[model samples]
Structures are given as structure tokens and as C-alpha cells.
Target: MSKLSLAETAELSMLLEVSANIKPGNIDRFHDYEDTKFRHFLASAVLARDVFERVPQMTLGEAMYAAVEHTNGHTGGNTHFGAFILLLPLIKGKGIAGACEAVLRTTVEDAVRFYQAFGKTQVRVNREDEMDVNDPASITMLREKQMTMLDVMRYSSETDMVAREWTNGFALTRKAADILKEKDGADQIQEMFLRLMAAYPDTFIAKKFGYARAVSVMERAQLVRAGGLSLSRFDEECILGGVNPGSLADICIAGIFTALLEGWQWDC
Candidate 1:
């Protein structure tokens, strides 16, 4: 049994990963993007943990909405919307696979709240439709279709990697957990991150760049993992290439948190 609170567990996960200097295209101790900083992640983790720890129960949407709303309030920008989306289901000890099913099992009320929560965050997607929380019909539509949050995620899963995780049972995150056992310290985090980027081909990069560009980055990442390219050299190149495997990074955060709760000894 671990001694850390869920909040502490969440915070430790954020701290350990963000303090690491080498997360390829994202902000870290070594680099900062113009809009997102390492500190923003730290703050988002604290806010997310606060929402996850609430008692007397919160609906999934309530937890997500509160977490994103509070996170944006603190950071004045979007920091970890994808992370919050992927992670809120796991905060209560549902293994990644179980959480995937759990998400699809959510209620219509949960869908409405999730839509409402999206309205509060600074997420980058275009939201011009029935998802508007203010519209009464959206709730009716949700009820009519019996659309759970995962159902909503499935609609985007074909295009969005994070949404795909909900539909795919968080297979990539589980793969990272297996990888975590083989490496140590910051290297453990970086290695898991790189391998995940290699395996998943980063839909964030695809969305921002093109699909071909994302595949090229994936191939390069696989080479670095295989030692055909040096980690530092490829890390730099990834940044310069504007390839950010952000969704993988978020899953890495959740994987690390789960590992820590299970008392993983990285230095072993």
C-alpha cells in the first residue's frame, strides 16, 4: 500500500515529469513554448487533483468541468485539457482498461456536464454545434441517443488520439507502464515518452502538421529508441521540427502517477 494521498499522487506525477528536462516538443525544465510553460503544468496538476479528490461524489462531467475550469482560472490558459480528459476516469483507481469502459458507460447527465465543462476550458477545438451547454436541446439529444462521454469521444476517436484512448482501452498508456519498469529516474520517463511517441505517431503533430509529417516524426522517434539516433540529438530535432507528441505526454503523466501509487522503484 502507498502512503500518498490521491492529490499527492497526482501532484508527484506532475512534479516528477515536468521537472525532467527532456520531453521532446513540450515545455520542461530545459525549454518553454511561448504559450505553455512548465509551471502551468504544475499548476494544472494541482487543480486537477483538487477536483479528483472531491467527496460525496461528483459526476464525471462535474469533475472534469471543475478541474478544467479551475485549471484555466489558475493558469489563464489551456494547459492540460487532454490530460484531464484522459485522466479523470482513472483518478479513483480504475485501471486504464477499466476506465475506458467506464467512460463509455457514463450517463447522459455526464455527457451534458462534459460538454458544459468544455465550455469553461481553453481547449483548442472548434465547438460550434449541439455541444453548447446552454442549449436545452443538447441535453435532450444526449438523452435520446443515450450518448455517454465515451460515445462523444468515439465520434472524435478516428481523428483524435486522446479520444482514441477512451475507445481503445488506454492501450498506449498501459504499454508505457510496462516500459516504465525497465528504465530508471528521468530516463524512465523519457524512454517511455519516446517509445509512446514512436508507437502512436502523435495525432497532435498530425493535426497541426500533416499526417505524413507525423509519421516521419514517429519513424525518427523509433530510430532514436533503437539507438540509430542519439536521444539528445533527436530531442532537439523534434523541437526544431515542431513535432509535439502531447497526447502521449499526457498519458505518460497518468502512467507515472499509477506507477508511483503502486510504489515503483525506478532506480531498481
Candidate 2:
């Protein structure tokens, strides 16, 4: 088999993440949120191909904003905004350690552009006290404080998993990639997703439903992992309660991309 290009690997990661079945609280082949359908995710992934391909020519912030723009044009909602945040750095830096260093080098202009991209998405983010992404005024604050994208990530790292990836050298994402490489078959994605949810309190769920609820979700994932809870039951409960662990999904996509880049086969 031919080696997949960076863009192809990135795009395939998005597609594979969403297509993985029985992903609790997420849009997958068998489930869809009312507003953001599975087809919307598919569209966003396909549309993002060009953006990923263009990453080398754009700054991290530029690539992120462009990706959100492309996704918004087709999906009519935020599907891959978080995924773009994770994937863009990895694609640009070409490896986990390289991505970490790349994020640290981001400029104030990158933070400004990232804010612009945040405005394009309806993603529910945990806001920092000083620079709220939802507020247009935060852009002025970002510039005044001279906060680079790395600075912004550090501020939000405590409450946001995606931002934490930026500050922590993509530790969880790299660990997830290792899990993917160690596992096999189509079930690998679902298994990795469950394991991640079991281990980490998904900040996306925390931001919307409170940290306590997020912990409960993680505990339930642990039960599922241990065979005490059913995967379908967990999926139904999350869907019924509107608990979407989107940040973990983004991380999973990054892991998938990383695994693919390292020549993990798509045998399933």
C-alpha cells in the first residue's frame, strides 16, 4: 500500500473518528445529534481536506480559521473546530514533540486569528476570566495583553482538554496514538475512545454539564470498560442526557492521525 500524505491522513482521521460505531455521546455511523448530523460531520471532514493540505502555507491560526470557515460553509455548524485545533498543529509540526514546540512559537497575531476562528463556531468553550472567546472585546484584550496562542492555551489548559494538549506537549494525544498502534481491527477506534473517556474527564462535557457530571460520565465509561456497563446503554444514556465528549473525540482524531502518520494500517 502507498503511504498516505499528511492531508490524506488528517482527513481520514476525521472520517474514521466519526464513522466509528458505538461511540458514546458522539455522532458516529450509528448515531447523530439533532443539529449536527452524521452527514454534517462527513461533509466537514471532506471539506477540511483542502485546509489540511494548505496547512504548510498557513500559520497555525490561519489554518484553524480557514478550517472553521470551510466547515461552516458546508456543515452549517461546528463539527471539526476542535479537531482542527488538534490536527493543525500536528500537521504543521509533523510530530507530537514538534507540534509542542510549534505551539510555543505562536505569536499574538495567532491568538487574534484564533479568536476570529472561535467566533465562527458554536462550540461551547470554557472561557478564561481575562479573554473570553465568546466576547468580541476579548480580541482587544488579547492584543493588549500581547498573549500568544500558547499563552491563551496555558490560560485555558486547566479547564479545556484541547487547550491542555497545546500546553502539555500533546501527552494524552500521543498516548492515544500509542494505544491505536497497539490495538487492531475496526474495534480499535471504539476501544481507544472508551479508554480515553474512562481515564480523562472530558472538559467539553465539563464545560456544558459541570465538572461533577463530567466525572460521572468518566466513571460510567470506566464501568463500560470493565464490563459492568453496556456500551449501547452508555451510548443511549449519553445521547438522552446530551453528554457529548467532543474534546475527547478531537483528541481521538489526532491520535488516529498520528497513528496513520506512523504507518498504522487501515486493515479494518
Candidate 3:
């Protein structure tokens, strides 16, 4: 009785049709197919879920849409296979019923939109053509360019109190703090941050996302002797002074791990 999200259900229905034994438009053979055919289809469907998750920028919805748009194209075939891999994890975590529905709903909408774009009547057709949306190289380009949505999502979902404190310490704007609150917001900010980091890896962006700062003997003494360095101290001395984040990796690491240790879990 695991609850399924709206998206997961949509994916499954398309999967059933896509993996069928009978050819397209062959209604009778498809209908009369043995129960075993369906059972196996169910199994393959599970595999597809796992595939979707591992794909870099593509979420289940994006991948499913890609599948419907270009099922015959090389990219579409990649998505088809990717969908199978995504199914396993979804099934184990969410029950079969819920997951299937999400999958079906997501995929069906994409199927319709794909047909409408070309002035064609929407059907359960697999076009498999080469569209920019279906480009297999999109994933590679994202990674090489360091602009992955997956990474954005992960950073957004995984960021915690310590990370927040760190950002606040850096004197991030109030809007920036709010942006870090949820996954979508975090993803948006992270995307921008990634670009900043790529351009200025030796600066603030890299420090926040990638590294830590070390406690100096004098800095440690201040903590022990005068109640630790406040984030304000770090902000005034570092942020305003334009000190690079790489120089503070140790401190950042300590703070991040401390926050994680305080108990954080991956987003659902």
C-alpha cells in the first residue's frame, strides 16, 4: 500500500504498451496474449524505473517524454532502456501499483504533447526521431559543462542546517537563504552556482559547494579563549575580503559533516 506520486503512475501504462509482444495496431493478438506475457511485461517494467533514476539530468517525466517523442531514434531507445532500469528502485521503495500509475500518467501526457507538436493526431505511437530533447549527448554535455539538474536536485534536497548556517555565515541575501529551503529552489540556485563555480572555481562558489576551511592556531585559540569565531568573523574577513573558499575547505568540511551527523536523509 505504498503511496504513489502522480508522476510514477503515468509511466507504467506506457511501459505496458511499449513492451508488449504484439505489433502496433494488432489488437486481437495483443488482447489474446497469455497472462505470462503480461507477467513478464510487468517484470521488464520494473527494470525501466531503475534506468530512469540513473540518467543524469532527466527526471522520470523528462525521460518518459523523450521516449514517446523518439522511440525509434537512438536516443529514444536509450530512454526506453533507461526506463526499465528506473523501475526496480521505484518498485522496491514504492509499491507496484503506485509506481506504475505515476509512470503511466507522466508518459501519457508526453505522448500527447509529442504528437500535437507535429500537427499529428495523438496516439500510442513511438516516433523515435532525433529531437534536441531526445539527444543522448545532452547528459554528457551537462556533466562536461557542470550543469546537471541531478546534481542541483541532490544539493537542494541534501542541504541541511549546517549548510544553511554556513550560507548565513557567508552573509547570503535573505532571498538566497529562502531559495535554499526546498529542492526546486535549491536546484535553481545550484544551477546558477554551478555556472559561477565553473567560471570562478577558485572563488566563493567553489568554496560553498565544494570545500572547507581549516581552523588556524590563532582562530582555534579565539574559539577556546573567546567563544569560537562567529560566522560574522568569517564573513567579514573572508567574504568581504574576497578570500577564496578553497582556502577554507577544512572548516567547511567540518561544518558540513557536522550538519550531516546531526541527522539528514535523502529527499523522497
Candidate 4:
């Protein structure tokens, strides 16, 4: 855990590379991509049973349980150590723990990249002169509220500065969630999507399904809110089936909550 394996390092490296080139409009797309990647990883884990069949002493369940618990902050709960023992054979050629670490580390990198990219897009700085003001000392003062276009105009800043000013202080995660929580959040989130579909009206269409599937999950878990949203049921099913949740942001938020609940303190 102290030394990230090659795969883990590669995943983090990819994240850092993407962070440098992030743009405002790419945030959502990036999140969607990460979510897909994570789901794929989980699926792979569940489907690798054949590879472990030859290892008589290895236990896949124990290994997977350990990986999930370690991530979920349930430290020392080797309840399923047998599964990991079973998985030992699959990773035998590549060090079972190392491979598992790599997969988990990749998830961590995706989480970082998703948020960092969002943060980068929110802030912009165009001119050389504005570079001086981009210092952490100055930026910290602005990370509070939404920097509006009008506010940028008043500052006489460069186009980049205006963009940066508008987003420099933006908190993408909270803002995205808030956007959903607000009176028109869902409509707004769905609106852009609808508009896009309208523009391509002749595209392949699917039957419209109500939120019935989602609602059922919320109801069974007693997580329904008068106004709040819950994916508890969906998430539970996904977890049991080794599937990813609806979005990267959702997965990241789940990790955060798990970490928080398990008292795993981090600077974040």
C-alpha cells in the first residue's frame, strides 16, 4: 500500500496528464468516461473466475472482499479472506496483491482526475499579465462563490481571466450536487441532454421509462426523500453484481462517505 505498483502509478500518471489539458465543457464527459472504466474493471473482476480455477489453494472471494473492504474503509475485516485466497491463482503470475492494488489504485486515480478536471475547467486565465494574479494567495480568496460573467467584465480581465474568475472559485462536486438539489436541478441536468437529442431528432430512439426502476430501489432502502434523491438500491445491486454505479461522481461520493464513516482521515 505504501508503494504504488506499476499499474497504480500508470493510472495516476494518466490522471495528471489529463488534468493539465482539461476544459470547462469536458468535465461531464470526463466523469462519464471514468465511470465507464470503473464499471469495466468491476466486471472484469467478476468474470475472471475461470483463470482462478486452476489454483487449488487460491481464494477469489477473499481477495475481492479484501480489496472492496480496504477501499470501503472496513480495515481488518478479513471476513472473506478465503475469496482473496481463491484469487491468488489468477494474479499468481503477476502477484495477486499487486494486481488487486493496481485495479484499486486505478479507481483512485479516476476519482482524482474526474474532480481535478472539473476544477481546472471552472478556472481560466488567458493573458500573460493575468498569470501574476493566478497565484494561490489570490485564488484562495475567490474560491467562495460563483464568478459570474458580469463580475469578470467589472474586473477588466482577459478572456481567460474572466473564465477563470467565473470558475476559479467554483466547487464542481458540490455545485453539481447542489444543481440537482435545487428547485430546477433535475430539469436543468436533463434539459441540456434533451436539447442535444432534439438537435439530432432523427437519431435512434428508445422507449421512455419513468423513474420507476430507481424509485423502487429508493423505497426498499427507506432512503426516499421528500426532495432528496437516492440510488441506494441501484448501488447495492451494482455492488453485489460487480457493476459500477450510475456515474463517476456518484462512485467518488460513495467512496468519500465510506471513508468518512470508517474514520479514514485524508487531506481531502
Task: Give the Cα-based TM-score of candidate 2 against the true structure.
Answer: 0.96
Writing each residue's lDDT as its tens digit, candidate 4 over 165-209 gives 122331222233233333321223432221221221110111011
Alpha-carbon lDDT of model 2 = 0.89
* Cα lDDT for residue 36, candidate 3: 26
RMSD of 1: 2.9
Q: Tens digit of lDDT per residue, candidate 1, span 91-159?
A: 644557557656766777778778777777655553453455566676778888988887888877876
Q: How close is candidate 3 to the true structure, as a TM-score?
A: 0.19
How many clashes in each structure? 0, 0, 49, 19
Judge candidate 4 at residue 248 and give its lDDT: 24
- For residues 1-268, write the lDDT of model 2, one tens digit per residue: 5778899889989999999987899999998777779999888888899999999999998988898888795544778888888999999989787798789889999999999998878878655456677788999999899999989888889988998999888988998898989966657999899999999999999999899999999999999989999999999999999999999999999999888888677676
List TM-scores for all candidates, in order: 0.87, 0.96, 0.19, 0.19
lDDT agreement with native, every candidate: 0.73, 0.89, 0.30, 0.28
Candidate 4 ranges with C-alpha deviation above 4 Å = 1-172, 175-209, 223-244, 248-268
The residue-level lDDT of candidate 4 at 71 comes to: 27
When summed lDDT is taken over every stretch of 10 residues in candidate 3, the lowest stretch is 23-32
Q: Which of 1 and 4 is the better model by TM-score?
A: 1
Give, for candidate 1, the lowest lDDT window spanning 10 residues.
124-133
* lDDT tens digits, residue span 239-266, model 3: 3433423212212222222222222211
Which has the higher lDDT value, candidate number 3 or candidate number 4?
A: 3
Residue 107 displacement in candidate 1 (angstroms) = 1.1
